[model samples]
Structures are given as C-alpha cells and as structure tokens.
Target: MPVNPPQAPTLSGDLLTIHRLLQSPTQIQRRLQTIQDLRFVADKILTARYRSSGGAVLYDVSEPIFNTREVESVAPGAEYPKDVTPEGAAALAAVSKWGQATQLTDERIKRNARPGDELDRVLRKVVNTIIRKVDSITISAVASAVTATSPAVDNWDVSTANILRDIETAEAAIEDLDMGYNPDSILMSSTKYAFMASDDKIATLRRRETTDNPIYGGDIEMLGNLKVIVAPASRLPSNDVWVFDSTQLGGMADEAEVDPGYTVGEMAVQIQSERIARRDAWEVWGRRITVPVIQEPGAAVKITGTNP
Candidate 1:
C-alpha cells in the first residue's frame, strides 16, 4: 500500500537569489572552494609596463627597412665612401579599447557571512578573472597581426632530430631578420605539451623520467634558450605555437586604483553600492584595455599543426 507522498516543500526564492523574509538579526551563507589554473600568458610577452591606458599610439621602426650591404673586393682605402646607407625608420602605434569584469555583493549577506576568509578569497579570484581576459585579447591581436608577408608557420615533427631541427629553423627565422631579433620565449597549449612529452624520439634520450605533480602544473622548463610556458587553453589554440623575443614585445598599460584596487584603463570607472534596510549591493566595474599589434612581425615565429 502506498500512502500519499508528502507534498515537496517549496522555497520562497531560488538558490541564486537572496531575499530576506524573516526578521532574524543574523543569516549565514556557505561557499565552496575549488582549484583554478593560473598560467596566464599575456604577461610573458606583452609586458605590463608596456601597457598604457592614456590611449597612446605605439610607434616603432619596421625591421630590415634597409638592404644588407654586399662586400666586394674594395680597392685599398676605397676613396672615402661617397655616402653611407641609413636604416629606414618606420613609426608604430597600437589602438586600444577596454575589457571589463564586475561583481555585485549583497550587504546583508556579507555582514552575516561565516567567520572565514572565504569572501575575501572570492573577491580576489574575481580580480584574477578580469586579468586573464586581457591575456585572451592579447593573443587574438598577435594572431590577427599575421600577414601574407609573414614568415611561413611550419608543422613540426615528433622525432628528436626533427624537434631540434624545427626549433632551430623557427629561431633562425627571427635571428635572420637582420633586425637584431632573438626569440626569448616559447608559448604552447597543453595538448602540444603532451604531444612533445610523449614523443618516443625525445623519450629515448631522457636520462631521467618525471611525472606531473599537481601542486605545480607540469612544465617543460626550457627548450634551448626559450622559456617554455604552457598557456591556458583560452589564450592559445591546441595546434599552434609561438616563439618571440620578449625584449621587443609590448603589453597592456594599466594603472591600479589606489582607493579600491581594480586595474584602471581608459574605460575604468567607479561603481557605487546601494543600501536599504536589510539589503545592500555593491558593484565593481572595469574593462580590458590593450591591443596586440606586431610592430615587427619578424621578431615572432609561429608554427601550426605540430600534433598533426
């Protein structure tokens, strides 16, 4: 025999909403904790100091604007060279807009929160999220900078010899720019990292074996002189790789808000909080402010479809 199931209880509000219905002086809320990836890539190449919020245009000379001089059997003390060739100079500028993120907290809820640093931790994570978006925007700029005249992006091989060969070829392209360029960093996606790590050719040469330790993410450390960094999937695509000189690279220009703490860009603004009897809501607002423009594409070398 089945008795009528007691009617399920109905909540006056949804889990996402917090509206006070009782006159209780205190309320309690609990938050969950989780691990998040922190491998941000934009800072690696697009240095923060290079970033500007005043809407300044970046200007730089184009690489190899002048032809290399050819050496001919010169006559002893060739009658004082008539003229000297000057390296052509070109101006560069980057146009930037803004990227933003915001969060609203209920005052009543905050006051009654449990005795812990959870709330502060949550807010810190919000700030980090906004910065990561900047990284994504930077990578997009680099990818779009690709032009028809840009050096070829090759597909790498898995064998040990091929790996060294490809890396050399990629590095040489920038060094050959005759523009005094040297690749100082290499950025890749996790998928590519696994592909390289599993290569039987390099594995055979390994004198010691190591496994990934979650405390610190798996990293390649270095490949030749370039620092090997695994960029978040959001910033780097799985099939592509980029090698570039950090010295010549420019990054986001932003200022930290002293009173508060959010990074201020051209689009930065303060958001006010609202308070009413048992309810209070505060807001944070900002925007991503940087554009990646390759002033000298020659300094960067990208390879595509290595896993393929």
Candidate 2:
C-alpha cells in the first residue's frame, strides 16, 4: 500500500500568513532548486542567442562518429558547453568572461589636478602648441589657394564672400579645442593622446615654461581653459576639449557597487547596454564637419600654385 501524506499543522498566528508557517528547510531548498532551474532555462535561451549571433564551438573529430561521441571529447574539457543544462548555463553566465576592466586614471589626473599642478601646466603648454600648429597650417593652405574669377561678373562678389566664410570657419575650429569627451584618450590613453602632438611642437613648448612661476599664472591657471590645437590636417576645432564626461568617469564606481542580488551576468548586461548606448549617442552627436572648404585664397585669380 502507498504511504499517506502528512496532514497540515495548525498555526498560532493568522492562517492567511501561510508563508511564515511553512518555512521548512526541505521546502525552502526545493523552492531554491526550482528558481535555479528556471534561471538555467533563461540562461540556455540567452546563450543560444549569443552563440548563434557570434559564438563559436570547437570539437574533436578524432572520436567515433556516432555512439562513441561523448560530451567531454567534443567540448572543452574544463568549460562545458553553455547550451547544455540550466546549471551549466547559469555557471557560464555567472563567470567573468570579458576583457580586463580598466579605469581612466589619466582623466582623474586631468580633473583632480589643482589649478597650479605641474602636470596641469604641462598639459596646457601641450594644448597651446597644438593650437599654434593648426593655425599655421590653415594660414599656409589659404595662402596657397589659386584665384578663380567667376565667368559672370555679377557672381564674383558672392564667390569672394563665400571663400572668406570658409576661411573663418576653418580658423574657428582650429581656435577651439573642445571636442566631445576625450574619446580617443579612452580608446587609447592620455599618454598616447598627448603623443599625437607634433614632436617639434611639444619640444618647443617644453623648453619655454617658467620654472617657478605661480601655478595659475599662465594658461594652466584654470582647469578647463587650456586649449590644445590638434593638427590642422586633422581639422579638429580649436575649442574642442578632450576630456572625459561624467558617464565614462563613473564606470569604476558602478563596477565596485556589485552585491549579493547582482550577479556577474547582470553586470555584464549593464556594461554591454552602456557601451551600445554610448556608441549610438556618439554617432549621433559627436564631432561633425561643419565648415565648407574654400579654394586657396588666390584660386579665383587664376594664379597657378604661386601666391601673389
């Protein structure tokens, strides 16, 4: 005969509050197991989608084709296939499988420097030299323009005006060094970004600084006021500020806040979402070529290559 099931025990408190009364270790364990199973299923679906999109599988074909093909021989010996059971899926998802996380120490260095810090002073000089180099290039390009007179006499004035406007726009961009964030720096590093400055320009500026002047006496006097000109050929604006924004700077803090409820899987998803959003936003609102190019100043005059 089959055994009879146990009858329910009466509770001292309200019967409606059944959750408090049914706190058996076995029941708790079972519920936890069920949750784990569901998580496993969710993980399998996610893993399949991920793998189908770009994941790859490696197999050892040395084993027998049919009955002898075991999971161990085909899949990684230590790392099992994520497509298997929920537990396996969960384990894969829970692990840190991404590249090493890095912090923007250079940005912090840029931001945390006091108004007169030596590093701050150095950065200012570097930026100013870049601006000067860009200005020189723009001037030279304009000076080399071939003069072009309109066939119709009436349009000559308009053409000349447009040429002047182009020059002004190009000059303005060279004057402003504020680009979006130091996106290039984030991809590379501050050292690399600084290296983009021409060696001659950097060397020239380094030799001209005052040894013991008040830290804030020159361009390095203000935190965000330093203007670094990029190469004119690069055509970056003079006012563009290459520094990190709040979101990029906050990444380290976000990673450090992980707790019990937050698994590595959740954090990875958040990071992916953040990167995607940042990339989309950058594509939409980042630096744009706003100025129209004018033929070198002498182009309209029909002068060949030679500046008058």
lDDT of each: 0.51, 0.24
Residue-level lDDT for 65 in candidate 2: 18
Off by over 4 Å in 2: 1-115, 146-292, 295-308
Can you write out model 1's per-residue Cα lDDT over 127-209, one digit (the tens) per residue?
Answer: 46655666777777766664312233334443432554566677887788677777888777776766665656555555554
What TM-score would every model get versus the actual structure?
Answer: 0.63, 0.16
Model 1 C-alpha lDDT versus the unseen true structure: 0.51
lDDT of 2 by residue, 1-308 (tens): 64476333333433222232122333323322332211211111111122111122222111221332345545455665343221111111111222212222223323332312322233233323333443343333323332232221122123222322222233333224332222111111122233322223233444355742223243222222222222322332221222212221111101223332222222122111011233221010000001112211211122111111
lDDT of 2: 0.24
**C-alpha lDDT of residue 61 in model 1:** 39
Candidate 1: misplaced stretches above 4 Å? 1-39, 51-54, 61-101, 107-118, 146-161, 209-218, 255-279, 286-288
TM-score of 1: 0.63
lDDT of 2 at 157: 22
